[model samples]
Target: MSAKTKNKHDQSESPRLGASAFSARSKRVTVNMGDGQKVKTLTPKQRGATTEQKSVAKDVKKVMAKCKEEHDMRLDLSRCEVTELPRYIKELSHLEEMYLYGNRLTTLPPEISSLLNLKILALSENMLSSLPDEAESLLCLKVLDLRHNRLKEVPFVVYQLRSLQTLFLRFNRVTSLTPEIKNLTQLTTLSMRENKFKELPEEIGYLRCLSVLDVAHNHLEHLPHSIGNCNQLVTLDVQHNELVDLPETIGCLTCLKRLGIRYNRIREIPAELEKCSDLEEFNIEQNKLKTLPEGLLKRFKNCSSLQLARNQFEEFPSGPPAQFGPLTSFSIEHNKVTIVPFGVFSEAKKLTKVHLKDNLISSLPLDFGSWVQITELNLASNQISKLPDDIKHLTKLEVLILSNNVIKLLPKSIGGLCNLIHLDLEGNRLESLPAEIGYLTSLTKLSVQSNRLTVLPRGIGHLVNLKHFSAGENNLTQLPEEMGTLESLEELYLNDNPNLQMLPFELALCRKLALMSIEGCPLGRLPPQVVDGGPSAIIMYLRTQGPYRAMSFS
Candidate 1:
């Protein structure tokens, strides 16, 4: 045949092979070249362009082949960028666990139900908006993690998964669950946090086996009364919601260990909650509560952590629980509390941390010395005028924040805080720091700025470990010569001290002092070394200008 007619004939006779045509047995096929000559040819290249989809298709085939040969029960295609699953996936009927998380898939295929033995399915962090109705056939599915998806509602097929023990739908768009959810008789965990749920269905009580139920960050207004039926619940967190009150039946959850209802509109806690004797952690802060339910504190025999901040209480919960337990941390800041009721904390000797800032209290009860185990005490922004001499009992305290108070003097006993590392007395009415302040050998930061101080105690030089010192905005005429002993000093701020006329030449001994601020001082003319240099240079000039005198602060 002529070349043109031969080419046309070959083109029209070219065999179009399907994907199956490339089987091992047909790797090579005989074809008529249409030129009166027969030629042997290998399998043709794949029909589509080489792209990510093509590679993924090959991966799916390989995985299926391997699983089919080994009869593997688990398959993980997580983060594989898979958008569409092949219908042949059903061939792996033995698969008991399947993870396709972090993929681009928007929907699952109905054929997925063919895996009747599947007990765990994780499709989290995907774009899935729905599951096929046929998924109800997965009767053995025990765990379903569909978090970080776009599902606007619970898939109806999910309720049919009678054996499901854990269902995580967090970070989804789901607004409500159907009453059919009660069908999950074996469900133990149900987390739907960060959704738009207004209220849970009353049928939720049917989940008697549920141990953890977290629906935080939703728009829930009230919990259904039937919730009390889940006596097995150990954790119930509804934080960041609009809940007006908890169901009185919550007291039925005797097994509850952690209950968080923060950031809600609840005005009063149900007295029935005191029945949860096993409760250990209770957080009800940022609410409209003015007083706790009577006998609430005494009932929490095992409670160790209590947070009652941002409330409207006028007095401390006095009459300390007659039989308090191992209370370790107590925070009641941003309240109207005036009387601290020292007797309340006297019973809890194991307390380690206390946050009583931003209150109206003018004085701390002398019983504060009883908390020997306390390590951090933040009593800032209160109306306190003087610290009890018993403050020396807090020898283990590491941080003491007493700023924005009207204290005129610090007790000499304050030096008893040997382990104190941070002491902030800023915005105080202090006229002077106690000479005993030098006893804090471990002190690293000390700020007495905006105070009524005339001079720093010579003992200040003993803070060998001090790295930052701020004594600005005071009536200081000069720094103590002992300050030169701060070998670890790195930053010093002495601005706005108008009466300050000169700095101690001993400051030159602070070899590590890199930053120094002495603005608003009326120091007269100085040599080049002192006028245009850092702390070290200025101190050096003073050392040469003034008579050298050896002094000992100790």
Candidate 2:
């Protein structure tokens, strides 16, 4: 056979040969050519195989070269499912930023320390059991986020990151912080909320540059006195903790603008807090404070708004410095206050709003009218029986709430309050309204529900701007025919009046009237004109037997 045919036959038989059989017969062959400088050429089959193998090898080399360049480049692989870092990651000497959030990474390779240029490292939402010792070597790291992890304790080496400015470890199981945490002098913000911290480290004061410290929703029973040493702190939220009392050193936070201590067991405030002159907002709500020291008011004289509701004070204190005139809004609702101090408001001339609801006030001082600048007053659920005549002096009063009181009558001088916009006297024993009430031309809302009123004054029609009038559950037997003059009236509640027999036909003239409720009245039907009037009127008529029921004005 020819050489080519012989080579093909050998290739076909090679597959049938056993591994040992083929190796036993394999041998190196040397051939000599006619020229003295001999040259041996491969057979046709061997040359084709060698050429193909070389081409594949070259392609693989090109691909491997590209992968090396990528492995050495900086990468931001945040929020991925990478279980472990590539071994070549150690070659990335230029890597500056790395984010590995929301992964199942259990441990980091010590080679991470090779990244000296890294500035931000986020490894949050991972199953990391502990940090590598080389973590401290990241000198250029500025921010570190490891929140929502099972970290029971922070590594001591973390304190060596002098360049760290912000650190977050929220929703972790950390029980204590190392005193070395204070070594992070460059840190400006630290969040460790929802932890098992029993108390703060005394060295915490060493973080003089910290502006925000959130240790809320923890097991902290007391704060370190050094906490007040953080002079630059502006916001401190320690709410939902077991703190029974605050340290007097808290007053040292002169730069604090907002302080929240709600949902704690705190019973009293530290008198040193009076020194927080720069404080603009302070919330101690939902505490066990029985009374506030008068000095606190003098200290926070610049405060414009204060919330002291849900406390144990039987009476509000009077010693808030006379210079605390800047106070414009005050709330003492839901307290044990039995009476408002006689002249408690005399010096509060700048006071614009006062809330005294849910108290035991039986009477108000005759001088209560001295709050001339007051615009809103809430005296609901009190025992007040009468208002002083001087109430007319409140010309600027726009809202007056006296609901659930025993008031028998309103001062006829109420008409002098031209600025009164809303008057609520619901749940009272009022028998009648003074005719002068009609002088409230600016009145837009009037509520007299659950009263003993028999009739409204004839001048009620003079309030052309009245948009809402509710007299439900009263002894009203009839409404004044002139009530139709309220061109702007939109809602009129007259239900539960068993004696009311008829409504005036003039109601048809109220072109803007929208809702009219006479459901429980003795009237059987509405006037024909009112029923045939514009679609804007929605009358809820009752079914009753009476001569007025058949009367029609059409």
How does each model score on lDDT? 0.83, 0.76
- Which regions of candidate 1 fall more than 4 Å away from where they truly are? 1-50, 321-323, 498-554
Candidate 1: tens digits of C-alpha lDDT, residues 1-554: 36586335323322221122111211334466888776746442332333445666687778777877999877777666677888999899899888776677899888998999998898877899999999989989998988779999999889888999988888789999999989997988888888999989999999999998989889999999999999999999899999998889999999999998999999989989988988898888999888887778888888898888987778766445453446898889999998887577767777888999999989988787877888999999999999988989999999999999999999999999999999999999998888999999899999999999999999999999999999999998888989988999999999889888677777766777778887776655555446567555665565555554343322
* Clashes found in each candidate (C-alpha, N, C closer than 3 A): 0, 0
How does candidate 1 fare on TM-score?
A: 0.84
lDDT of model 1 at residue 542?
A: 59
TM-score against truth, every candidate: 0.84, 0.68
Write out the backbone clash pairs for model 2: none
- Tens-place lDDT per residue, model 2, 1-554, is 36586346333322121121001111233457768966775552454435433443343344334534766333544434445665455666676666666556777888888878888777777877678888887999887877767888876768889998888777688999889988899988888877798888999999999898888889888999999889999889898899999999998999887787877889988788878876776667677888776667766656777777777768885574363466788888778788776677777778888888888989987678788989989999888999989999999999999999999989998998999999999999999999998999999999999999989898999999999999989999888878878989999988888887677655655656778776677664556554454223323232122333353423
List the lowest-lDDT window of 10 residues for candidate 2.
17-26
> In model 1, which residue pairs have backbone atoms overlapping below 3 Å?
none
Cα-lDDT of candidate 2: 0.76
